[model samples]
Target: MFDDVIQEDVLLEMKYVYDYVKIETAFPKYATKKALQKYSSPTLLFAAENDVFFPSKLIVPRSEQIFSNLTKTVILQNSSHMQNNANINKILTEIEYFFSN
Candidate 1:
């Protein structure tokens, strides 16, 4: 899908793409600990145990401390960034439970 979009767009400039990539690379610098610490709303974080991009060990603790309101963190075992059908169902069940209570 992404490849098709890139291929079809004749006017897509390389400079614009480079700039976007540069901004994305620098996102963590602006989206800092202090920024996360300001969150006060209830949050449910589903962390994939095997996800390299957002590791559960690092994110869970920081999230717990950051959110002033009730924060629930579920570490889905044997799951990657893109969850399987079973894991997706599990997440839906968790969301339903979270909302009901």
Candidate 2:
């Protein structure tokens, strides 16, 4: 029964409300301690210094505590959500090392 959906109406009313609820719901539901504990095997977690989604210092410690075989964590000071620049290079280096020897 979804019809007559105007672009502006969706964008202005439904999308804003949906986005707000989604943002509020996502955090508490997703990143739980038990959820983190499920990760097994050698894991490499890369967190950016400027990331809004995941804070490096906070998440890194949890990862270390959770994963028994967590190989390494690379915190890129000059990086954001997307890994770019020398930090990305360093991450690649770490990944290479972890896989190699």
Candidate 3:
């Protein structure tokens, strides 16, 4: 009975994701290599210094290589994958600066 309930939950979740993806397909999807070659717009990368999901060290250099028009990288010091209010404020500030400049 428990297994059946779990399977139903999983199927429901999968259907939700599939529906969401179908709706999202209206936007352009770019492969990393293709985006690197094709994209030529200014871009800013805000990286959390202490992010567990995506380490700054790995993401920074890889982004630098990929983004032809890379503008800047703002490192949010002592931050993790899930940001606090302070981090959100910092991110907003960085975005404002990026757009203004």
lDDT (C-alpha, whole model) for all candidates: 0.68, 0.67, 0.73
- The 10-residue segment of model 3 with minimum total lDDT is 1-10
Order candidates by TM-score, high to low. Answer: 3, 1, 2
- The local lDDT score (0 to 100) that residue 36 gets in candidate 2 is 65
Once superposed on the true structure, which residue ranges of model 3 sit more than 4 Å away at CA?
1-34
Candidate 3 per-residue lDDT over residues 1-101, each given as its tens digit: 01112355656877797877666435354338565687778999988777875668877887877787889998877777666667778899989988998
**Steric collisions counted per model:** 0, 0, 0
Error of 1 at 98 (Å): 0.8
In model 1, the number of clashes is 0
Best by lDDT: 3
- Tens-place lDDT per residue, model 1, 59-86, is 7776666566645778988766666667
Number of the top-ranking candidate, with TM-score as the measure: 3
Per-model TM against the reference: 0.63, 0.57, 0.65
Give the distance in Å from residue 72's predicted Cα in candidate 1 to where it truly belongs. 1.7
1-101 per-residue lDDT for model 2 (tens digits)? 12223456545776677767655444654455576666666788887766767778777887777677777777877556544445557877888898898
Q: What's model 1's lDDT at 98?
A: 89
RMSD value for candidate 1:
7.1
Deviating ranges (above 4 Å) for candidate 1: 1-38
- Name the 10 consecutive residues with the lowest summed lDDT in model 1: 1-10
